[model samples]
Target: MIYLQLFWEFFKTGLFAVGGGMATLPFLQAIGESTGWYTYTDLMNMLAVSESTPGPIGINMATYVGFTAAGIPGAVVATIGEVTPSIIVILIVAAVLHSFRNNPYVDHAFYGLRPASTGLIGAACAAVVLEVLTSIQLVAQEGGILKTAALTLDAAAPLGGVLNLRGVALAAVLLVLTNWVPKVKGLHPIVFIGLSAVVGVVFGFAGV
Candidate 1:
């Protein structure tokens, strides 16, 4: 029953979230609110992890949310649900190629979709930025430096309840290395992801 629910929810999300992964953020937020499976904070973390990992951000987020909610079976169901709509749509459109090929209505529909997609994607980006920058003002106000610092760290790891400065430093260093080093310019993102994971593990073991 839980698996079925997961599938239905994600199917709806994928069906309507037409733009891209970022575009899916709003729908995912709607799902989060409707299902109570997670919170806005959880959504932010999912976005971060999804972007940092392999595969499309939307699919990755769906899998993450599903797994977090109901484990392995949930992940499978959610993934299939997210992709099923695309498969069905493509098949249907292929079968109706002539009806759509030279239709001005179809062309106009697509022309309209361009901006709608952009708006959805832009909204998603803004939401994520809000989550990350939620504490900026605290940090900006000199009197609340500690509070600001705490909020900033909470944005990264909600469970730790404390800032993991080592992890933050690791991320900062990687960002610099990836941007400034010519040799690292073309490296696959997975390499950096693996390195970040290793760094996180090491820091965790060291009690940092």
Candidate 2:
């Protein structure tokens, strides 16, 4: 029953999360809230680990979440569920794409999808930024995104409780290294991700 639930949830995610891996964040969040399987912190950690290692983020996340929920079999079922839709859709698209390649409606549909994809990805980015740079765990505790968001807007909130200074510092440093530093700017992103992992380990052990 749990396995079936995992498959159904990921199947829905894969079917409707139209843009790409990053675009699935919103659905992933919804799944976490609905299932009580993981928390927002868990999702962020999943994103970090998924993006840092191997294949598509969505599939990786599905595997991780499934494993966490029901071990090995759940992982397999969830992964298959996540990819099944893509395989089916690709088959359908391939069979008819040649016929529709020049159709005005098809072109317009693709054009329309671009903005929707951008918006989904943008929302995901905002959510990540909020999680990392701000202490918005109230949403995790109470499941009130609107309430926590409103709290963030309060000018009189205590600084120490509102901002994650270490996260802010790390993000600032990474941004500078990636965008401004001549020697570092050209390095592949995986290099930073690896370094960040090492730093995270150190922070963890040091109780920071």
Candidate 3:
């Protein structure tokens, strides 16, 4: 039953999340909230891993979530669920695309979708930025709306005191290196990614 539920949930996400992998973040976040299968932090981590690895982010995330929930079989089911809609849609599109290539309605529909996809992707990017830049967490308090508060690394510190300075520093370094330094700007993105990983390790060890 859990496996079936996982498949169905991802199928819905695949069906509606039309703007590519990043756009699926909102749906995945909602799934975490509704199913108790994962948390927002887990989703963020999943996004990181999905982006770094060699597959579509949405499928990678589904596999990770499913495996965490129910092991290998769950991973297979979740992946199939995530890709099934795309497969069906592509088949349909391929068959009808030539016939409707110049149809006004089809052209207008695609034009409308472009903006919608852009908006969804933009929203996802904003969410990622907020998650990385701020140290806030949402908590539900009794008889009230959700409360927002900063997270502290040390228990002794006051609330909203601690920030992920390491992340900020790394982001700043990468931005400067890629944008300002001509030598570094010419390097491939993979080089920067490798350097960032090493820096992350150093910061991790330094308790940053």
The candidate that wins on lDDT is 2
The local distance difference test score of each candidate is 0.77, 0.82, 0.80
**On a 0 to 1 TM-score scale, where does candidate 2 land against the true structure?**
0.58
Model 2 per-residue lDDT tens digits across residues 43-134 = 89988899778888878988888887889998899889888999999999898977899999989998999999899889878878986677
Candidate 1 lDDT, 88-121, residue by residue in tens? 9988988787677899987898899999999988
Candidate 1 vs candidate 2: which has greater lDDT?
Answer: 2
List, residue by residue over 32-105, the lDDT tens digit for candidate 3: 89999889998888888987797777779889888877899989998889889999999998889878988999
Per-candidate alpha-carbon RMSD to the true structure: 9.1, 6.3, 6.6
- What is the lDDT for 58 in model 1? 82
Question: lDDT of candidate 2 vs native?
Answer: 0.82
Q: Report how far off residue 116 is in candidate 2 (Å).
A: 3.4
What's model 3's lDDT at 46?
A: 81
Candidate closer to the true structure by lDDT (higher is better), 2 or 3: 2
Worst 10 residues of 1 by lDDT: 131-140
